[model samples]
Target: MYDLGDIVEMKKAHPCGVNRWEITRMGADIKIKCTGCGHVVMMPRREFNKKLKKVLESKADQA
Candidate 1:
């Protein structure tokens, strides 16, 4: 599961060639920033959830 500040890997790489993204915002939609090119993308929660492959880090675990 993903939450704010989670670093996740997408099933496919971004056009910028980065598959790793950081979750900066979350709600009905999820916003992620590319770890390689600093690009940002916003997608609906359902789609994002489907595309999510791995959770590299969890914000909840930081506390």
Candidate 2:
């Protein structure tokens, strides 16, 4: 499972030319911030699962 502050790679690239995003919030919906353009988007977990490529780093990993 993904938690807040995790950096992840998406299956597709963002328009801003970044595949990396940081998880800012989690619940029934998930909120992620784009690392390149700094855009924030909120979507359901199912949609997130479809879009996510892999978890690059988690808070624990960073620590």
lDDT of 1 by residue, 1-63 (tens): 778989999999988877889999998989999999999899999999899999999888998
* Candidate 1 TM-score versus the reference: 0.89
- Measured with C-alpha atoms, the lDDT of residue 39 in candidate 1 is 94
**Candidate 2 Cα lDDT to native:** 0.92
Q: Model 1 misses residue 6 by how many Å?
A: 0.4
RMSD, every candidate, angstroms: 1.1, 0.9
For residue 39, model 1's alpha carbon misses the true position, in angstroms, by 0.5
Error of 1 at 16 (Å): 2.8
TM-score of each: 0.89, 0.92
Report the lDDT of model 1 for residue 59: 83
How high is the lDDT of residue 29 in model 1? 88
Clashing pairs in 1: none
**Who wins the TM-score comparison?**
2
